[model samples]
Target chain A: MADKLLITSSPHIRAAKTVRSIMLDVVIALVPASVAAVVFFGVKAFGVLAASTISAVLAEYLYEKAVKRPVTVGDLSAVVTGLLLGLTLPPAVPLYVPVVGSAFAIVVAKQVFGGLGTNFVNPALAGRAFVLAAWPLHVTSAWLNPLTMDAATGATPLHAFKGGQAAGSLVDLLIGNRLGSLGETSAIAILLGGAYLLMRGVIDYRIPVAYLGTLGLGVFIFGKPGALFQGDPLRGILLGGAMLGAFFMATDYVTSPVTPKGRTYMGIGAGLITLLIRYWGDYPEGVTYAILLMNLATPLIDKFVVPRYYGYAHDVAARRKANRAGGELS
Target chain B: MQFISILLAGVLTSNFIFMQYLGLCAFVGLSEQFETAIGMSGAVIFVMTFASTVAAAFEQFILVPFGLEYLRTIAYILVIAAFVQLVEIFLKKTAPSLYKALGIYLPLITTNCAVLGAAMLNVKNQYGILWGTVNGLAGALGWSLAIVIFAGIRERWKFMNIPEVLKGFPLALISTGLMSLGFLGFSGLFKTILK
Candidate 1:
């Protein structure tokens, strides 16, 4: 009888979720945007997605094998990173762009700093940043027109919008009729995926809510060139990668803050930076950099915004004083 | 309005460490701990501000009048070294704990390119003493912001299982590169606004 009961360490009762399961859910959540990309941008978008996803997995497997570490490709985090990177890129980039970007994302951004959760910044965004820097012309201007899939040389809606011209109708923006990154064009699709993630409890609500809310508020306040409180907030949130980033990238479990309050601050900070970049900086889309900047700040936020131990809520000051005293002593 | 633009440019667009890649020796050396980074930041803010003021004064009263532009670099270094010495003495007397914390890096500020760079930039921009001081304060604030944030990130590296090859400076450089990538968002921020 005693032999029938397995002896184990603490945490004998395990949660049903695993890293693979969580990653699988994220993959599912991304499907709407992926489908939207293919529908809007044609077969090339599919190729970009496949190239990045496969290359990311392959890079992780090869790097792990080379370094004699346990292979973690089965966890599917690489797939998510690759897919996210592909989604953020211009739809018509050469295949090598996704390949190189994914390889860099997996090996340098994710694996080198210790794989997955240990990476300081979001791996996909880091890859996008690298590719953007390496091939600025291709990454920034390779936009495809919806349905026709013709190369678009005109300014994206974001650029026109920044120039105080009307971007498009609200419905067109929602259905992704504008020229932009592959998956970021379709606001509705991204929202669907974000809703799924929120409902499944896979991501915290504070980040997306705070992010979009602050962005909306900011756009309203200072969006128009010669007017205040007259800018179109609805158009602001729907345009560019704000929808996609607020939902997917900014909520990455690894690079985001763990505490709820810290996550909210992260969201607000990202929003403010995005506004700053979009309004005044060279970039038309600020979502990627804004999220990456906030990721850098996550550690600072976590360090300062620690949650109080349960039942010791009122002892916060005393605990802080004690900790400071202990620090001085050390 | 010009002051605001200069401040924004100094703090974000042309950050001393991330953008210009100046004063990296102290940036990497003193960023291991958060408390120490804060101490260094305060020291830099003091030394850089005073150094810029004095350098601008020298440039205005001595270099330009004497047509001694050739000696500008040496004169700026002298001004910086003098200011660093002043900071060392002041911190030692007023804040011994911070003085001990800053220790070698305090004196090393004499060699920090950001300080000299700020002074030189003031001369190049032909900023008056007041504007140069503001620029100095902005640059130092930007450097302090980078180190403090970096120290926060590095503090967590203690628990991470970083790969053997990429430990220490290699990893630090990689992290700094990625951070610089993030800071790229701030590039051209002043193009539209300040125009």
Candidate 2:
């Protein structure tokens, strides 16, 4: 009779969602941008994606096996990380770049810190940062023209945008017909993916909304060289990796803040840093570094931005007064 | 404008801990808890600010006048050590609570490379007393920001299932390296604007 009755801890009722399911949803949400990347950048982009994804999975499997831990490759977190890293790269980067980048992401960034959830920074962004630092020339100037697949000789649209010149037509920018990173060119594809994530409740709306909103507002005020409130905010969000970073990278579960208010602060911080780097710094794009910096601040945000207890809905002063009076509320 | 640029450079672009790689001993040692990190930061700020001013004065009145430039490092060290001792004595007499909070870290600042480095930088850049003090304050503030943020991160690691081989310094240094990478965005931040 004792064996027939089952007992468990207080959280006996569990949600059906597992880590694998959530990761699978993320992968599904990324499908639109992935498809758009291949369509625009052609075969080299596809190769880059494949190499990074495969190496990330292989790296995780090998590291876990070597360390005598149970292999977690089946969870598909590695796939999402690898694919995201691949998407952030230029379409014309050397094949070894993605291979090395994804391996570093999985081993050093993810596993060395005790695997996925325990990692302090976003693994994909860390990988991108590592490879960028290692091979700055390849990462920065390896842009390929969409459809033509020819190496782009001129500065990226983001560079031209910084000079207060129009970066191609608004239509081209929206459809990803301009030169840029593999996954950052298409505004429509990224927005579609972001919408899917938002609709499925996989990501909170506050972060993306706050991030893009802050950036848009900032551009409107200070985007032009010698003017205020005359800058083009539409082209601002559509160009470069701002869209990609806002939707996919900044919204990562482990590296971002857990509390709602903390997430909003994270978004605002990332947006401001992006503007600072883009407008004043030497870097042509700031989204990667912006998100990475905010990832570093996530712990501090969580430490300070705690949620209020449900029963104690009043202000802290009132709660303290009640406590001092030694009386229970009727 | 120059003051603002130098201040911004010290705090952000050329941060002593993250970018310039100075004063790592105290950075790694006292970053275990947020409270202690804050304490060390206050002591360093005080020491560094005064140390820079005194060192600059010594450089101008003693070293430059006597053509004793070769004794810059030794002279700066002596001055900084003396200044830290004075601070220790003053804090103990005036603010016992603050003195107690600083604890052993008060004396340890005497050997901190960032303090010496700040003085040397001011001499190298030919900054006078006031500017040297500002640089020192800015550098210490940046160092404090890094350690405080890092302490917060390390506090969270208490709950993490970190592996045995990579427990303390290995993981700490690795995280620091990653953070430095993020700070790299500010590398040439002053290029177009300030120049």
Candidate 3:
């Protein structure tokens, strides 16, 4: 009789999840926000979304093909990045902005770093930051009114809130009637999508909960113009990209911490930075930089905020007890 | 007030790495290890301060009087290279341990743009010998501060689950970009404070 024995290292058990499946789930969860974006911003929103998504996928394909790496466009990660990048736009950003932004996100931020999993910061945010820096006038002053799709300007709610003024009634802000980024204005829709992801177990509750919770607390504590403990926590939470970012971006597996406690800390730290920027920073919004900065800090967080190894606590206790007994005998 | 502005501008506002975008080769290459970064930073401080003073005096006394001010670049380079060589020899003789720690980076400082840049900037700004020395020292300190902090971040980055393509240089570049963003906060800081 002949017998064959195959040996492998650890990781004896494997899950069925693939990168494709998870990315698909993320894309599905973003549908509500995209739909809401189009509903609020009309065909222009759809144009930006389509342009970004297509350009991102094409950029990834070209990059992989040029570098002789296996094409990973099938993984759908680029699609998710494009979608997120689209949603973060100011709705009036020219068609070329998303195209260029998506290309940058894919080529420089995502592919040049060795593609998807290797990107340090979110590719979408990197692209956004790049464009924001390159064309501050476009990114900053490109806001449009919700229903009319015409140029409407003044201060965004975060700006008004900063100046101790109200941008709209709470209901208008909640139902996504405010002027803001393409997908970020609709707090209710974002919550709907966030709920789906949470229910599907696609994300950890620790990050979003801790993120929004800390942001609300920080805003309430230090948000007032000149006084402490006088800011509107609800308005602060419901106003900007806080909902979208807390649920989606901050929880990016590659960029966020792994362990449970570390994730919580990542969320809270991002929230604190967001509040700091909105209240005290020169820019009116901080979610993008806040999350990006926290992503940069994720490695540090993982290094220091580690979970205890199995049975290590017992080993330490035993060692301590042995040392005590030895001392008594001496 | 003027001295404070100069110091603040060099150390934060016009940082050699983030602001002037000089000496980035060393910044990216030697920033992988904390001890190595500290060692490199020490060499930079010594060479920059010493070279700035020497180059300034040469430009002010020798080049200016001779009507060869356009040769500032070549003169500064020669001065920095000679100074770095002297420091290397002195370090090897007096402090073998530090020489070992700094290794080849000591000689590499001859090409380190921060040193040459500091020397040239001192000339361009037309700073006096004292102000030029302060600026050079502060610029090196700023470079050291940036590298040490980046090294701390990169040291922790080793344990991270970085993607394959972005594992080394690409990740370092992105980290640098984000860091530059953070440093943008220092823009006009002194102006605001003074106002």
Q: Report the candidate with higher TM-score, 1 versus 2.
A: 2
Model 3 lDDT per residue over A1-330, tens place: 011111132221111125667788889899989998999889988999999999999999998888777677877899999999999989888988999999988987767656666566778888887787778888877888998889877878778887888668988887788888988988888888888888878789999999999999988887787899998889889888899999989988877877688889999988987886676556667888888878767656655565665566745554445434322221
Each prediction's DockQ against the real complex: 0.81, 0.78, 0.17
Ranking by lDDT: 1, 2, 3
Question: Model 1 misses residue A155 by how many Å?
Answer: 1.7
Docking category of candidate 3: incorrect
Error (Å) of candidate 3 at residue A321 is 27
Clashing pairs in 3: A113-B165, A113-B166, A114-B165, A118-B163
Candidate 2 structure quality by residue, lDDT tens digits, B62-93: 99999999988898899888888888889899
lDDT for each candidate structure: 0.87, 0.87, 0.80
| DockQ pick, better of 2 and 3 | 2
Stretches of candidate 2 exceeding 4 Å from the true structure: A1-17, A313-330
Q: Where is the poorest 10-residue window by lDDT in model 1 chain B?
A: B99-108
Q: What stretches of model 3 exceed 4 Å from their correct place? A: A1-16, A209-218, A260-265, A272-282, A303-305, A310-330, B1-14, B32-35, B42-104, B119-195
Instruction: Give per-residue CA lDDT, model 1, range A55-85, as digits (tens).
Output: 9999999999999886778778999999999
Provide the lowest-lDDT 10-residue window in model 1 chain A. Answer: A7-16
